[model samples]
Target: MSNDNHITIYEHEILRIDRGEKRVSVNQLKALQEFYGESGVPYYSLIHNGVKFCEYVGVLQVGDTLIEILPKVDKNLTDSEASWRKVLIDMLHAVGLFNLQAPSSSNLKLNSNSILDLYFELFVKEVKYLLRQGLVKKYRKTEGNSTSLKGSLKFGKHISQNLVHQERFYIQHTVYDTTHELHAILYKVLKLLLRINTNQSIQGSLKSLELEFPEMPDLKITEATFNRLHLNRKTQGYHNAIEIARMLLLNYHPDVSKGSNHILALMFDMNLLWEQFVYVSLRKFKKGNTTITAQNTRNFWKTSKGSKSRMKPDIVLNIDKADCVVIDTKWKNIKNYNPSPEDLRQMFAYMKYYKAKKVALIYPGTDFSNSSGFYYDHDKYGAHEIGKEECSVISLPYNTDIRQWQKQIALDIYNWVEVNDESSVDC
Candidate 1:
């Protein structure tokens, strides 16, 4: 590679010179060579921050002072990869990056934000319990002094001389106080900061691995295939990479704060999204398959007249090849909260425009019209509605029993795709 490809090295203190040799890894050496050059020595340049002393030199040694390199100033960083980066970090932590198997008694402790998030989760659980117990109720006395009405009766209770019939009660638990809201904001920010780095690493690794191992390769079942299989094992198991990097960060930078500023903070932390994407992508890849996401939109205009109003579809199937169909994931249950006309219309539009033979609007529940391992189809609009079409609003119960939602999310995506693929037909 040339000097153009060299990775610039930045000192901990901006533009500071390292007076002594520092041990560098083989990989780090390679990275530096690629950024600078084998023969070019690094030197301080006040105007450019740092530059090569000369072209085409030899390997660098310790005590060979190099000025810190400076990166270009970024102004629109709020709109940049910072958001996705946070998500990447979080994913890494979730997937065994943070000494996952170490004894709980280990001296390692989570940052303040992690502790705050833990507390917030606990707080939510407490609120749910309090709600279940019902809110405070007020009691009142009713008339009836024949026997002195020994104990007071509740309001709306008809007292017959001395005896009381029943009690009427009122309860209220919908409290959104400052304390609760603050906790929620704090929890979200902390969670985002914690997970973003891991998420990015997972995504970068997955993409790189996929490019190297195409799904539909034509090959004979021979030694080459066996070697490739072993390589796949190493590539998929990125636990070592995650652990090493995490250990380095935790050991070197113990004072860094891990918290997000706002919702955009979550965007910078792509850990959750990376996990969701990689899990879905790789599982399909492993099975020599492809997947798609569904898109939905609504319009109240005829095809010829354009639209008087518009409604965006909840989801659309974006996959290109293979049997085409559309499906959407909903965290809500369909039974308790029936789909509205808008929801049905949106789904129908997706089916009509996408030319999909079957459309599934999946909800998080185990109930449907037919069997439990369920599958069903219906044309709900009865041919009179503006955007009526064939649709299957199936309820697939989420495995809530699983303690780790991330693992369960991957499993759910794989199982759903496997069972519902067009080839299966019976899903």
Candidate 2:
């Protein structure tokens, strides 16, 4: 490939730099430094002749002039493969950009120019639907000086400040208002979307929506704001849409210093993405007397100075008040279909600490056969007798149809647990 300003590389693939060409410019270096400082994850790895890339799988702008480099797709996927498109869809869904209630059509394909393009397209669609229904409104408290004292009077402030003018008295009223939490959230979303690099259509749509929003100062929305929202018939429809917009805006942190030269790119770690997908999908199986928990943490070891170390299992199955099964999701290709020693040791710790009947290690890929023997027996694969507790390494296949894949995963898990639970009871 010739020395072009824009470059795209795949995941785990190294890009070599020519001896004469400048690889890392000063401005790119500064932007990268700032990105690392803010995100705390090294986006790229610099080596002697080239750079070893990491989790970020999107376009990155380097230098003050904003030269764009598109990172490589996953190590398993080729650039021209249709699977890359699926990966993009999964990425959007993982970040709550896609609506979960409306399942993605099996035949639907995105003609997006870029990831941000697709995001803005969907965002505009949802916003338009919301507008058709009219914006959500609530009774917000209004405080000001009133001549007739329409609401509760602040006698202390009224007497101190307005004693000279007996005509006006300071009062507060809880009036039915449209400019409440929902409008504040929507306003922030519009502002953040405008900052991103998008097409003319999206830009025009956002501007139109902006005019429709109430004239309120952008409010810093926190987790508390989401919790405080009362979801009845009126606000329930907008809940998911508002949340998706809120999350995207919150996660968006771009280098605005490059002015108009910088490209808008959002990247997600496959490791974290796989974990989140598994956790969310597993929740479907939570039936009577059973509960599913993700990122379940507990102190497994204690230091001599009284400090405690924690053990966090990715997914935990609590059956009848006991931690029955612990699962850990891995985002790597297993060699010879065997779990690595390090992964085994980690799962072993969970089994010991939680007294779990079984521990499962899940990976993402579809090469393996979905047969019964896929699960590793106790003595097999060097996971010999620590106890009667069983350990299984399962692969969750990545299919173009994500909904079907998720359903298969739920069934696999349910069956695995049902068989194991019966055997354990007999023992």
Candidate 3:
């Protein structure tokens, strides 16, 4: 995964990817515009003679170039792309999105060019592992013209074709082999990698895998095609390879008009990733008798004669059996600005519904410190008075050591939750 064909940009960044003998070529730009036009600007918006990346942070591949979009928090922190790229990969790994193998994950996170490249390398490894195990074979029904009769015979066609000779019979027979639907899907993904993979370091491995794998018929694949595949206990080892194949196959969008400028985008929403990352971090390093649940829902509003609406918070921390803290994660830097009225109101609503004394909005804080304050209520006459419930703003620290960063987030959350402990009984 070299930087020769890779381009890294931050979130909300704009670049003029024009046609020329430059880093991003004209064909690549055309492919990108086509993808953007079809995809409706989910990753980046198509602007005037350039592209403006949105809030999504992930790898997108068009033609032979790899575009790595990352999350940007501080504008003044002059850090290398390798550093942010490592952070992005670390976050993805923490949340169980990227299943990077050992030694390569630890040893080469810095050297990896983009998320997709790392993923392609992992796929190569999985295919190699399956190769080592020797592909599984199953009994499948196939039709062929044979001199020796087997199974059911196509009598009408056999009599017409072999009328004079009357020896060869077009028969449908059962044969146990590897040319099944699973192999067909895997072969398709391998062929796709051969055409789209730009990482030169692993070109040999891809070709080797393509050669080793038995050629399978081109299939019209869909979601149901994979859902219909059946795997036995003996073939359970294909789980990982199949999972990655599912992702790649489902996300692949081929060019119908030109067919050569196809785009394979593997992008993820930063907002959802951040929420899952925070929830996973807290759950991983939580204290005793504490539980963390994500997307916990509660019915809040309902029509008189219609279905009820639910209010789902990103995270809810419970102690024993009682809800303790309602936490909301935001993938933004909340430095030098107050929380918005909408966010505060949402937190308040969560506190009221979940019966949690405190609600916190967690942000990726590279520069902000944690702060907690009480909500205000109308006093006895008409003045404003401090309320009982607490609203805290917590910012988690960042570090190259991803585990340590997760642990720090857990520590900060626990400390903030117990800042004003009322039941302080010595253990």
Tell me, by TM-score, which candidate is best.
Answer: 3
lDDT of 2: 0.63
Instruction: Highest lDDT: give the candidate number.
Output: 3
lDDT of 2 by residue, 232-324 (tens): 898876765676665666555655776534434456666777777777777654445667888888888888999998988888888324548
Tell me the TM-score of model 1: 0.29
Q: What TM-score would each prediction reach against the true structure?
A: 0.29, 0.68, 0.90
**Model 1: per-residue Cα lDDT over 1-427, one tens digit each:** 1121222232121221233232333433333333343554233112122223221111122112111222111222232222222233344444433333333213333331222222223322332332333422223333332322234433333333213423322222232222322122223323323443222323343343334321332222322322333213323332232223222222221112222211110111122233343344333344344454423354546666764666443344334433455655443444645556565565566656666645565554443321112122445534433222345555543322322334544445445544543322122
Question: Which residue pairs of candidate 2 clash?
Answer: 9-72, 10-72, 10-73, 27-63, 28-63
What's the lDDT for all of these models?
A: 0.34, 0.63, 0.79
- Candidate 1 vs candidate 2: the TM-score winner is 2
Candidate 3 yields a Cα-based lDDT of 0.79
